[model samples]
Each structure stands twice: as structure tokens, then as C-alpha cells.
Target: MLLDLINIRKVRRAIVYFGLILAALFFQNTILAKVPILGVTAMVIPCFVVAAAFFEGGVWGCVFGLVLGIFYDLSLAGTSLLFTILLPIIGFASGSLVMFFLNRRPLSFFLVSAAALIITAFCQMFALLVFSQTKVLPLLITGALQVLWTLPLSFTAYYSCRKISGLDLSK
Candidate 1:
């Protein structure tokens, strides 16, 4: 009976992981990309990664980040190795912070989302500064803008996941 319960729990976690992945890909390819922004665009996949980390901590958050990073890299046809390193770092950092402050207060949710966006933006900025040929200032500016745009979305996703999963983060 105990083994059956463990299996069921594992299955549930797997389902949630896959579901988040599909949702991330769909949002990236369809919803976020198709939005007719005049000149600027937001990085929805980062927001999704942030949401995953905020809601599901520990190894799950890292896994989500790694998977989503690979997907994002593949879809963009850019270097996959860079994102494979960056995304998981962003995920693990943000998720670790969330886990550290697992209080279920409304404020906690807001803080985590903000932290996720900030961390992701910083990662992008650092990567551009170190590896990419792009100008550092523009990358930093755009990353900052993207973080602002993504924070609200991350908050909504995190809150909704908390509600649906019945996971009390306030402890």
C-alpha cells in the first residue's frame, strides 16, 4: 500500500511537470510570439520558468528550468548550451529563495515573482555581457523591461498554481 502511494505521488509530480512544459511551449510559440507588440517584446518563457520555480521548489524547479531552457534554445535556433546552463541556474536560485521563504502570505507570492523576474533578467544581462556579441547596455535595458512585463504574469501563474495544487506555502 505504501509503495502504491509513492507511485501515485511520483505519477502526479510527473504529470504536473509535463503539463507545465507543454504549457510553456504553447505559450512561447503561440501566445507570446504572436502578440503584436509595436517595437518591444516580453520573454514569456522566462516568466514560465519563474512560475515553475516559485510554485515547485527543489529538484522539480531545476528540472523545469533545464527543460524549458532547452526548448527555448531549440525553438530560437540559437546556441542551446548557453541556455542549458543559464536557465537552470535561474530556476534553482529563484526556487531556492522561494523555498527559503515558503510563507503562504500574499506578499510572499509577490516577492517570489519579483525575485524570479529579477534573477532571469540578470542572467540574460550577464550572458550577453560575457558571451554574446550584442551590446551590453541594450541587453540590460531590454532585460529590465522584460522583467517588468513578466512579473505580473509570473505572480498570476504562481498564485493559480498554489490554489490549484492546494499547496500551503505559508508554512
Candidate 2:
């Protein structure tokens, strides 16, 4: 009986985690786009990926990252195959790396966020350069800007997740 209850609790947590991911994605796509400053610029999917990596470890984080990345690609208007494929790989690597170095310190949030941004930027740059045959310099600049915006947002999301889920990630 106790084991079943525990399993149920875990299942509930997993559901809540996935629910939050979906909600964040939706908000990022719709309502967030309306805001003048922060809207449309935020990298909510990457932030959620970091959160999943932090809380759920490597495998699950990678899976969630793939799902979030695919959703992101789908939300866009034009046809972009690379985005759908590359993002998942990036997410998987970032999540796995973060979990490998899993620490109990608060600084992990910043570190993980930074790593996520860097990985995302690199993936984007690669896609633009190789697949799209675009100018690397402009893509690099934009990727940097995106990283700057994503850093703090990732931290905030991680903090909120910890608060809501009551997961003591701090050491």
C-alpha cells in the first residue's frame, strides 16, 4: 500500500513537470509574444530543458528536451527540418552533461543556464551555417543576444521549479 502511494506521488510529480513544460511553451508562443520587451525573445524551451535536466537527471531531461524542441519547431510558420532535429540532440547533450556534473550548490543554476545557452547557440549557428548556407557572423551575433536573454530567465525558471516542486537541489 505504501509503495503504491509512493509510486502515485512520483507519477503526479512527473505529470506536473510535463504540464509546466507545456504551459511554458504555450505562454512563450502566445502571450509572451505580445509583450514588447521580453516577449518573443525569451527562450522558454531552453529554460524548461535546463529545469528538467536539473531536476530529472540526464535521460528524462533529454527526452523532455526533444519534446520541447520539436514543439518549438512545430510552432514556427515556415518549414524548418534542421531545427526539429538539431534541438533534440542539443537538449540531450546539455541535459546529460549537466546531470553528469550534478552538484548541490546554488551556483549550479547559473552554470547550467550558461551551458544551455552556449549549447543552444552553437547548435543554432551550425544549423544556419551548414544547412541554410547563411552568414555565420550574423547568426553568432543573434545567438549571443539570445543567450544573454536566456540566462536570467533560465535561472528564474529553475528557482520557481524548486519552489513549486519542493525539490531541494541546493546542497
Candidate 3:
């Protein structure tokens, strides 16, 4: 009975996560891209990964980030290597912060989400500077604002992950 319950929970968690990623991808590509806010669209996938890290820790974070990144990269711009490498790093950082110092609070969620976005921006900036012979300052400035625009929704991701993972953050 105990093993059955455990398996059920695992199955439920998988479904929840898969659903969340699907929604994020759908929202990002279909709706958000068409109607840009100041010519910037939100990337909710990383927020989902960060929330998963905070709730389930590094292993789940890494796996989710890796798989989602690959799926995302197969269609989006740039190479697969960027998202594949960068998102897992964000997950690792989110997991580290959660494991070492933070709880699954909204504040923690916001901070982790913001950090993930900033790191992603930096990585993009670095890639642009290295590979593309184009100006990166504009990208940096806009990316920072985009990060800010996306930060408030981290709480939504955090709560969603907690509900999906069947975790009680109050404990």
C-alpha cells in the first residue's frame, strides 16, 4: 500500500510538471510572442524550472531544465547548447539556494527567479559578444527590464510547483 501510494505521488508529480511545461511553452510561443510587451516576451519555462528546484531540489531541477531546454531549443532561436547548458545551471543555483539558505517562500521564489533570469541574460550577452559580431548593450538593457517584468510571476510558479509536488512549505 505504501509503495502504491508512493508510485501514485510520483505519477501525479510527473503529470503536473509536464502540464506546467506545456502551458508555459504554449503561452510563450503562441500568445506572448505575438503580442510583445515593449518588444520583449516573457520566458516562463525557466521560472517553472526554478520553482521545481526549490520544491524538489537539484536532481529534478536539472532533469526538467535539461529536457525542457532541449524541447524549447528545437524550435526557438540560437543553438540547443545554450538553453541546454544555461537552464540546468539556473536549476543548480536555485537548488543550492533552497537547500542551503532559503525556504519555499514567495520571497525566495522571486529572488531565485530573478537570479535565474539575470544569469540567463548574462550568458546570452556573453554568447552574443563572443559569437555574433553585433552590439550587445541594447540586448543587455532590454533583457534586464524583461527580467524585471517576469519576476512578479515567480510566486505563481512556486505555488504551482508546491501544489503539484505535494509539498507543504509551511513545514
Write down the TM-score of every candidate: 0.76, 0.76, 0.87
Model 1: per-residue Cα lDDT over 1-171, one tens digit each: 778557886678768767877877787678866763444455666656656666677566688789877877787765647567767876787678777757545577567666666666777677568877788778777777776666656655666556545776556
**lDDT tens digits, residue span 1-171, model 2:** 778557887788778877877787777777656653532265656767667666666676677777777777788877766546655565566567666766635577677677767776787678669989998777877777777866766766677567655766544
Q: Stretches of candidate 2 above 4 Å error?
A: 1-6, 35-40, 79-100, 169-171
Tens-place lDDT digits, model 3, residues 1-171: 778557886777778787887877786789657765778766667898898898888888887788778878876875557888878878877887898899878877887788788887777678667888668778787788778767775667778888877877566
Backbone clashes in candidate 2 total: 1
Considering every candidate listed, which one attains the maximal lDDT?
3
Error of model 2, residue 45, in angstroms: 1.3
Error of 3 at 171 (Å): 3.8
Candidate that scores best on TM-score: 3
Candidate 3: lDDT over CA atoms? Answer: 0.79
Per-model root-mean-square deviation over C-alphas: 3.2, 3.6, 2.7
**TM-score, cand. 1 vs. native:** 0.76
lDDT of each: 0.68, 0.68, 0.79
